[model samples]
Target: MTRDQVLEFVKAHPASFMATVDGGEPRVRAMHTALIEPVGLTFCTGVNKDVHRQLVANPSVELAYWDPKTGVQVRVRGEMEHLDDLDLKKRIVNDVFTFLQPVVEQFGYDVLSLFRLAKGTSIVWRAAQGAAPMEVAEF
Candidate 1:
Protein backbone atom coordinates (compact mmCIF):
# COMPACT_ATOMS: atom_id res chain seq x y z
CA MET A 1 0.00 0.00 0.00
CA THR A 2 1.09 3.58 -0.53
CA ARG A 3 1.58 6.11 2.27
CA ASP A 4 -1.80 7.66 1.58
CA GLN A 5 -3.43 4.24 1.77
CA VAL A 6 -1.73 3.58 5.09
CA LEU A 7 -2.99 6.88 6.48
CA GLU A 8 -6.52 6.12 5.37
CA PHE A 9 -6.41 2.71 6.98
CA VAL A 10 -5.11 4.22 10.21
CA LYS A 11 -7.78 6.90 10.13
CA ALA A 12 -10.44 4.23 9.84
CA HIS A 13 -8.85 2.11 12.57
CA PRO A 14 -7.55 4.58 15.12
CA ALA A 15 -7.85 2.28 18.07
CA SER A 16 -4.48 0.76 18.77
CA PHE A 17 -2.46 -1.16 21.32
CA MET A 18 0.46 0.95 22.47
CA ALA A 19 3.56 -0.66 23.92
CA THR A 20 5.92 1.15 26.26
CA VAL A 21 8.73 0.11 28.56
CA ASP A 22 8.48 0.40 32.32
CA GLY A 23 11.75 0.01 34.16
CA GLY A 24 13.09 -3.01 32.31
CA GLU A 25 9.71 -4.52 31.52
CA PRO A 26 7.15 -3.99 28.81
CA ARG A 27 3.65 -2.62 29.13
CA VAL A 28 0.84 -2.45 26.66
CA ARG A 29 -2.51 -0.71 26.70
CA ALA A 30 -5.39 0.12 24.42
CA MET A 31 -5.34 3.68 23.06
CA HIS A 32 -7.57 5.50 20.65
CA THR A 33 -5.83 8.05 18.51
CA ALA A 34 -7.18 11.58 18.58
CA LEU A 35 -6.21 12.31 15.02
CA ILE A 36 -4.47 10.89 11.95
CA GLU A 37 -2.24 13.49 10.34
CA PRO A 38 0.01 13.53 7.34
CA VAL A 39 2.98 13.40 9.65
CA GLY A 40 1.91 10.49 11.86
CA LEU A 41 -0.33 9.27 14.69
CA THR A 42 -1.48 11.46 17.56
CA PHE A 43 -2.40 10.30 21.06
CA CYS A 44 -3.00 11.69 24.51
CA THR A 45 -2.77 10.42 28.08
CA GLY A 46 -2.64 11.67 31.62
CA VAL A 47 0.73 12.92 32.75
CA ASN A 48 0.46 10.78 35.85
CA LYS A 49 -0.30 7.70 33.81
CA ASP A 50 2.31 4.99 33.74
CA VAL A 51 2.33 5.08 29.96
CA HIS A 52 3.36 8.71 29.98
CA ARG A 53 6.04 8.18 32.58
CA GLN A 54 7.37 5.17 30.76
CA LEU A 55 7.54 7.05 27.51
CA VAL A 56 9.41 9.86 29.20
CA ALA A 57 11.92 7.43 30.64
CA ASN A 58 12.22 5.50 27.41
CA PRO A 59 10.89 7.03 24.26
CA SER A 60 10.87 3.78 22.29
CA VAL A 61 7.40 2.53 21.53
CA GLU A 62 5.35 0.36 19.20
CA LEU A 63 1.78 1.07 18.24
CA ALA A 64 -0.32 -1.65 16.65
CA TYR A 65 -3.69 -1.09 15.07
CA TRP A 66 -5.81 -4.08 14.17
CA ASP A 67 -9.21 -4.22 12.55
CA PRO A 68 -11.05 -7.45 13.23
CA LYS A 69 -13.68 -6.75 10.61
CA THR A 70 -11.13 -6.06 7.89
CA GLY A 71 -8.60 -8.60 9.13
CA VAL A 72 -5.82 -6.06 8.76
CA GLN A 73 -3.04 -5.02 11.08
CA VAL A 74 -0.57 -2.11 11.06
CA ARG A 75 2.32 -1.86 13.44
CA VAL A 76 4.37 1.34 13.87
CA ARG A 77 7.58 1.40 15.83
CA GLY A 78 9.53 4.55 16.71
CA GLU A 79 10.42 7.06 19.39
CA MET A 80 7.56 8.91 21.03
CA GLU A 81 7.79 12.68 20.72
CA HIS A 82 6.33 14.63 23.61
CA LEU A 83 4.37 17.54 22.25
CA ASP A 84 3.94 20.86 24.05
CA ASP A 85 1.14 22.27 22.03
CA LEU A 86 -1.50 23.57 24.40
CA ASP A 87 -3.77 24.49 21.54
CA LEU A 88 -3.69 20.93 20.34
CA LYS A 89 -4.52 19.70 23.81
CA LYS A 90 -7.48 22.03 24.02
CA ARG A 91 -8.66 21.19 20.56
CA ILE A 92 -8.43 17.48 21.13
CA VAL A 93 -10.13 17.54 24.50
CA ASN A 94 -12.77 20.02 23.51
CA ASP A 95 -13.40 18.67 20.03
CA VAL A 96 -12.15 15.25 19.08
CA PHE A 97 -12.18 13.74 22.57
CA THR A 98 -14.86 15.64 24.38
CA PHE A 99 -15.40 12.67 26.64
CA LEU A 100 -12.12 13.56 28.28
CA GLN A 101 -13.23 17.10 29.05
CA PRO A 102 -14.28 16.29 32.57
CA VAL A 103 -10.95 14.69 33.32
CA VAL A 104 -9.15 17.64 31.79
CA GLU A 105 -11.27 20.02 33.80
CA GLN A 106 -10.59 18.16 37.01
CA PHE A 107 -6.86 17.60 36.57
CA GLY A 108 -6.32 20.65 34.42
CA TYR A 109 -4.80 20.70 30.94
CA ASP A 110 -1.30 20.11 32.28
CA VAL A 111 -2.36 16.66 33.43
CA LEU A 112 -3.11 15.81 29.82
CA SER A 113 -0.04 14.82 27.86
CA LEU A 114 0.29 14.75 24.14
CA PHE A 115 2.50 12.46 22.07
CA ARG A 116 3.23 11.99 18.41
CA LEU A 117 4.92 9.30 16.35
CA ALA A 118 5.60 11.66 13.48
CA LYS A 119 8.00 9.48 11.50
CA GLY A 120 8.16 5.73 11.99
CA THR A 121 8.62 2.49 10.23
CA SER A 122 5.28 0.78 9.75
CA ILE A 123 4.61 -2.79 8.70
CA VAL A 124 1.19 -3.88 7.53
CA TRP A 125 -0.14 -7.40 7.33
CA ARG A 126 -3.34 -9.11 6.34
CA ALA A 127 -4.73 -12.08 8.20
CA ALA A 128 -4.18 -15.23 6.16
CA GLN A 129 -4.88 -17.92 8.69
CA GLY A 130 -1.30 -19.23 8.93
CA ALA A 131 0.77 -16.98 6.78
CA ALA A 132 4.06 -15.48 7.90
CA PRO A 133 4.53 -11.81 8.74
CA MET A 134 4.52 -10.20 5.33
CA GLU A 135 5.47 -6.63 4.55
CA VAL A 136 2.44 -5.12 2.94
CA ALA A 137 2.97 -1.35 3.29
CA GLU A 138 5.73 1.23 3.52
CA PHE A 139 5.73 4.96 4.29
Candidate 2:
Protein backbone atom coordinates (compact mmCIF):
# COMPACT_ATOMS: atom_id res chain seq x y z
CA MET A 1 0.00 0.00 0.00
CA THR A 2 1.08 3.57 -0.60
CA ARG A 3 1.95 5.93 2.22
CA ASP A 4 -1.37 7.74 1.97
CA GLN A 5 -3.23 4.45 2.00
CA VAL A 6 -1.36 3.29 5.05
CA LEU A 7 -2.06 6.57 6.82
CA GLU A 8 -5.74 6.37 5.92
CA PHE A 9 -5.93 2.88 7.29
CA VAL A 10 -4.28 4.04 10.49
CA LYS A 11 -6.72 6.95 10.82
CA ALA A 12 -9.72 4.69 10.20
CA HIS A 13 -8.45 2.26 12.82
CA PRO A 14 -7.25 4.60 15.57
CA ALA A 15 -6.63 2.06 18.26
CA SER A 16 -3.41 0.06 18.12
CA PHE A 17 -1.07 -2.01 20.25
CA MET A 18 2.06 -0.17 21.31
CA ALA A 19 4.95 -2.45 22.16
CA THR A 20 7.89 -1.46 24.30
CA VAL A 21 10.78 -3.25 25.96
CA ASP A 22 10.43 -4.12 29.60
CA GLY A 23 13.01 -6.31 31.35
CA GLY A 24 14.17 -7.57 27.97
CA GLU A 25 10.65 -8.74 27.13
CA PRO A 26 8.15 -7.08 24.82
CA ARG A 27 5.25 -5.46 26.64
CA VAL A 28 2.24 -4.55 24.58
CA ARG A 29 -0.60 -2.21 25.48
CA ALA A 30 -3.59 -0.76 23.73
CA MET A 31 -3.41 2.95 22.87
CA HIS A 32 -5.15 5.53 20.76
CA THR A 33 -3.41 7.37 17.94
CA ALA A 34 -3.83 11.06 18.63
CA LEU A 35 -2.60 12.29 15.31
CA ILE A 36 -0.61 11.39 12.22
CA GLU A 37 1.67 14.11 11.01
CA PRO A 38 4.24 14.25 8.25
CA VAL A 39 6.87 13.23 10.75
CA GLY A 40 5.29 10.06 12.13
CA LEU A 41 2.59 8.63 14.34
CA THR A 42 1.76 10.74 17.39
CA PHE A 43 0.26 9.26 20.56
CA CYS A 44 -0.13 10.11 24.20
CA THR A 45 0.00 8.23 27.49
CA GLY A 46 0.19 8.92 31.17
CA VAL A 47 3.71 9.63 32.38
CA ASN A 48 3.15 7.12 35.17
CA LYS A 49 2.11 4.44 32.75
CA ASP A 50 4.22 1.32 32.35
CA VAL A 51 4.46 1.86 28.62
CA HIS A 52 5.82 5.36 29.19
CA ARG A 53 8.41 4.07 31.62
CA GLN A 54 9.41 1.39 29.18
CA LEU A 55 9.80 3.96 26.46
CA VAL A 56 12.16 5.96 28.64
CA ALA A 57 14.27 2.85 29.09
CA ASN A 58 14.13 1.94 25.42
CA PRO A 59 12.95 4.38 22.79
CA SER A 60 12.53 1.69 20.19
CA VAL A 61 8.96 0.47 19.86
CA GLU A 62 6.54 -1.30 17.58
CA LEU A 63 2.89 -0.52 16.83
CA ALA A 64 0.55 -3.14 15.42
CA TYR A 65 -2.98 -2.91 14.06
CA TRP A 66 -5.24 -5.30 12.25
CA ASP A 67 -8.64 -5.34 10.60
CA PRO A 68 -10.29 -8.75 10.80
CA LYS A 69 -12.96 -7.90 8.27
CA THR A 70 -10.48 -6.71 5.66
CA GLY A 71 -7.82 -9.23 6.59
CA VAL A 72 -5.22 -6.47 6.65
CA GLN A 73 -2.60 -5.89 9.30
CA VAL A 74 0.04 -3.21 9.73
CA ARG A 75 3.15 -3.25 11.87
CA VAL A 76 5.18 -0.13 12.52
CA ARG A 77 8.57 0.00 14.21
CA GLY A 78 10.42 3.16 15.09
CA GLU A 79 12.07 5.32 17.71
CA MET A 80 9.90 7.34 20.06
CA GLU A 81 10.51 10.70 21.68
CA HIS A 82 8.63 12.96 24.03
CA LEU A 83 7.52 16.19 22.46
CA ASP A 84 8.25 19.12 24.77
CA ASP A 85 6.44 21.75 22.80
CA LEU A 86 3.78 23.50 24.81
CA ASP A 87 1.80 24.43 21.73
CA LEU A 88 1.71 20.85 20.59
CA LYS A 89 0.57 19.76 23.99
CA LYS A 90 -2.18 22.34 23.98
CA ARG A 91 -3.28 21.25 20.55
CA ILE A 92 -3.42 17.63 21.60
CA VAL A 93 -5.30 18.44 24.76
CA ASN A 94 -7.86 20.50 22.89
CA ASP A 95 -8.37 17.88 20.22
CA VAL A 96 -8.41 14.84 22.48
CA PHE A 97 -10.67 16.40 25.09
CA THR A 98 -13.16 17.69 22.58
CA PHE A 99 -14.51 14.17 22.25
CA LEU A 100 -13.92 13.35 25.91
CA GLN A 101 -14.63 16.61 27.67
CA PRO A 102 -17.06 15.37 30.26
CA VAL A 103 -15.01 12.33 31.11
CA VAL A 104 -11.72 14.21 31.18
CA GLU A 105 -13.18 17.05 33.18
CA GLN A 106 -14.28 14.57 35.78
CA PHE A 107 -10.88 12.87 35.82
CA GLY A 108 -8.93 16.16 35.90
CA TYR A 109 -5.94 17.38 33.92
CA ASP A 110 -3.59 15.13 35.86
CA VAL A 111 -4.49 12.61 33.23
CA LEU A 112 -2.81 14.91 30.73
CA SER A 113 0.55 14.86 32.46
CA LEU A 114 1.84 12.40 29.90
CA PHE A 115 2.58 14.41 26.82
CA ARG A 116 2.61 14.36 23.07
CA LEU A 117 5.03 11.66 22.05
CA ALA A 118 5.81 10.39 18.57
CA LYS A 119 7.22 7.30 16.94
CA GLY A 120 9.62 8.61 14.36
CA THR A 121 10.79 6.94 11.16
CA SER A 122 7.79 4.63 11.37
CA ILE A 123 8.15 1.65 9.04
CA VAL A 124 4.94 0.17 7.72
CA TRP A 125 4.51 -3.50 6.89
CA ARG A 126 1.58 -5.25 5.30
CA ALA A 127 2.55 -8.78 6.21
CA ALA A 128 5.56 -10.98 6.67
CA GLN A 129 7.88 -9.64 3.97
CA GLY A 130 4.96 -8.27 2.00
CA ALA A 131 6.54 -4.82 2.01
CA ALA A 132 9.83 -3.20 2.78
CA PRO A 133 10.36 -0.77 5.61
CA MET A 134 9.50 2.78 4.67
CA GLU A 135 11.16 5.67 6.46
CA VAL A 136 8.63 8.08 7.88
CA ALA A 137 11.03 10.59 9.46
CA GLU A 138 14.31 11.12 11.24
CA PHE A 139 14.56 12.29 14.85
Candidate 3:
Protein backbone atom coordinates (compact mmCIF):
# COMPACT_ATOMS: atom_id res chain seq x y z
CA MET A 1 0.00 0.00 0.00
CA THR A 2 1.02 3.59 -0.52
CA ARG A 3 1.67 6.14 2.22
CA ASP A 4 -1.58 7.91 1.48
CA GLN A 5 -3.44 4.61 1.63
CA VAL A 6 -1.98 3.79 5.02
CA LEU A 7 -2.83 7.23 6.33
CA GLU A 8 -6.33 7.01 4.94
CA PHE A 9 -6.87 3.65 6.59
CA VAL A 10 -5.68 5.04 9.90
CA LYS A 11 -7.95 8.04 9.53
CA ALA A 12 -10.95 5.81 8.86
CA HIS A 13 -10.19 3.84 11.99
CA PRO A 14 -10.24 5.93 15.13
CA ALA A 15 -9.22 3.37 17.74
CA SER A 16 -6.00 1.44 18.17
CA PHE A 17 -4.15 -0.68 20.68
CA MET A 18 -1.09 0.94 22.18
CA ALA A 19 1.73 -1.17 23.53
CA THR A 20 4.35 0.08 25.96
CA VAL A 21 7.30 -1.55 27.65
CA ASP A 22 7.66 -1.64 31.41
CA GLY A 23 10.83 -3.25 32.64
CA GLY A 24 11.10 -6.43 30.54
CA GLU A 25 7.39 -6.93 30.08
CA PRO A 26 4.99 -5.39 27.55
CA ARG A 27 1.66 -3.76 28.33
CA VAL A 28 -1.14 -3.09 25.84
CA ARG A 29 -4.26 -0.97 26.12
CA ALA A 30 -7.05 0.27 23.90
CA MET A 31 -6.88 3.97 23.02
CA HIS A 32 -8.50 6.48 20.71
CA THR A 33 -6.57 8.55 18.22
CA ALA A 34 -7.20 12.19 19.06
CA LEU A 35 -5.85 13.35 15.72
CA ILE A 36 -4.15 11.80 12.70
CA GLU A 37 -2.69 14.77 10.95
CA PRO A 38 0.14 14.82 8.41
CA VAL A 39 2.67 15.33 11.19
CA GLY A 40 1.87 12.18 13.17
CA LEU A 41 -0.57 10.36 15.36
CA THR A 42 -1.86 12.10 18.50
CA PHE A 43 -3.60 10.64 21.53
CA CYS A 44 -4.61 11.45 25.08
CA THR A 45 -4.65 9.60 28.35
CA GLY A 46 -5.02 10.36 32.02
CA VAL A 47 -1.73 11.39 33.58
CA ASN A 48 -2.27 8.99 36.48
CA LYS A 49 -2.61 5.93 34.27
CA ASP A 50 -0.04 3.19 34.06
CA VAL A 51 0.47 3.79 30.33
CA HIS A 52 1.38 7.39 31.12
CA ARG A 53 3.98 6.25 33.63
CA GLN A 54 5.30 3.65 31.23
CA LEU A 55 5.68 6.29 28.50
CA VAL A 56 7.50 8.55 30.89
CA ALA A 57 9.95 5.78 31.64
CA ASN A 58 10.32 4.79 27.98
CA PRO A 59 8.98 6.80 25.10
CA SER A 60 8.99 3.91 22.65
CA VAL A 61 5.53 2.56 21.78
CA GLU A 62 3.60 0.57 19.18
CA LEU A 63 0.06 1.07 17.93
CA ALA A 64 -1.96 -1.50 16.05
CA TYR A 65 -5.20 -1.51 14.03
CA TRP A 66 -7.24 -4.30 12.44
CA ASP A 67 -10.20 -4.44 10.10
CA PRO A 68 -12.16 -7.66 10.23
CA LYS A 69 -14.06 -7.25 7.01
CA THR A 70 -11.04 -6.32 4.93
CA GLY A 71 -8.64 -8.74 6.61
CA VAL A 72 -6.22 -5.85 7.00
CA GLN A 73 -4.04 -4.84 9.92
CA VAL A 74 -1.61 -2.04 10.53
CA ARG A 75 1.09 -1.60 13.13
CA VAL A 76 2.84 1.66 13.94
CA ARG A 77 5.91 1.80 16.15
CA GLY A 78 7.55 5.08 17.15
CA GLU A 79 8.80 7.39 19.84
CA MET A 80 6.23 9.31 21.82
CA GLU A 81 6.23 12.74 23.45
CA HIS A 82 3.93 14.41 25.93
CA LEU A 83 2.69 17.60 24.29
CA ASP A 84 2.42 20.68 26.52
CA ASP A 85 0.82 23.19 24.20
CA LEU A 86 -2.60 24.36 25.39
CA ASP A 87 -3.84 25.22 21.91
CA LEU A 88 -2.96 21.80 20.56
CA LYS A 89 -4.67 20.20 23.52
CA LYS A 90 -7.78 22.20 22.82
CA ARG A 91 -7.80 21.15 19.18
CA ILE A 92 -7.54 17.51 20.17
CA VAL A 93 -10.39 17.84 22.65
CA ASN A 94 -12.59 19.49 20.09
CA ASP A 95 -11.81 16.90 17.43
CA VAL A 96 -12.38 13.94 19.73
CA PHE A 97 -15.58 15.35 21.20
CA THR A 98 -16.98 16.11 17.80
CA PHE A 99 -16.67 12.47 16.84
CA LEU A 100 -17.98 11.23 20.21
CA GLN A 101 -20.91 13.60 20.52
CA PRO A 102 -23.45 10.97 19.60
CA VAL A 103 -22.89 8.93 22.75
CA VAL A 104 -22.21 11.72 25.26
CA GLU A 105 -23.33 15.16 26.27
CA GLN A 106 -21.40 18.29 25.52
CA PHE A 107 -19.52 19.62 28.53
CA GLY A 108 -16.78 22.17 28.88
CA TYR A 109 -13.34 20.92 27.90
CA ASP A 110 -11.24 19.26 30.59
CA VAL A 111 -7.47 19.17 30.85
CA LEU A 112 -6.89 15.91 29.11
CA SER A 113 -3.26 15.00 28.67
CA LEU A 114 -2.02 14.79 25.06
CA PHE A 115 0.87 12.99 23.45
CA ARG A 116 2.36 12.85 19.96
CA LEU A 117 4.09 9.84 18.52
CA ALA A 118 7.12 10.79 16.45
CA LYS A 119 6.86 9.78 12.79
CA GLY A 120 10.42 8.59 12.45
CA THR A 121 9.59 4.99 13.37
CA SER A 122 7.72 2.66 11.01
CA ILE A 123 4.30 1.53 9.84
CA VAL A 124 3.51 -1.99 8.69
CA TRP A 125 0.30 -2.73 6.81
CA ARG A 126 -0.96 -6.17 5.87
CA ALA A 127 -3.90 -7.19 3.77
CA ALA A 128 -5.09 -10.51 2.41
CA GLN A 129 -5.61 -9.22 -1.12
CA GLY A 130 -2.34 -7.34 -1.38
CA ALA A 131 0.83 -8.63 -3.08
CA ALA A 132 2.71 -8.38 0.18
CA PRO A 133 2.64 -6.57 3.46
CA MET A 134 3.83 -2.99 3.17
CA GLU A 135 6.42 -1.52 5.53
CA VAL A 136 6.72 2.24 5.71
CA ALA A 137 9.60 3.76 7.64
CA GLU A 138 8.77 7.39 8.34
CA PHE A 139 12.16 9.07 8.20
Per-residue C-alpha lDDT of model 1 across residues 108-137, encoded as one tens digit per residue: 899889999887678888887448866744
What's the best-to-worst order under TM-score? 1, 3, 2
RMSD of each: 1.6, 4.2, 3.9
Name the best candidate (by TM-score): 1
TM-scores for the candidates: 0.91, 0.72, 0.79
Off by over 4 Å in 1: 136-138
The models' CA-based lDDT, in order, is 0.86, 0.67, 0.74
**Clashes (N, CA, C under 3 Å) per candidate:** 0, 0, 0
Overall local distance difference test of candidate 3? 0.74
Candidate with the greatest lDDT versus the true structure: 1
Kindly give the stretch of ten consecutive residues in candidate 1 with the minimal lDDT sum. Answer: 129-138
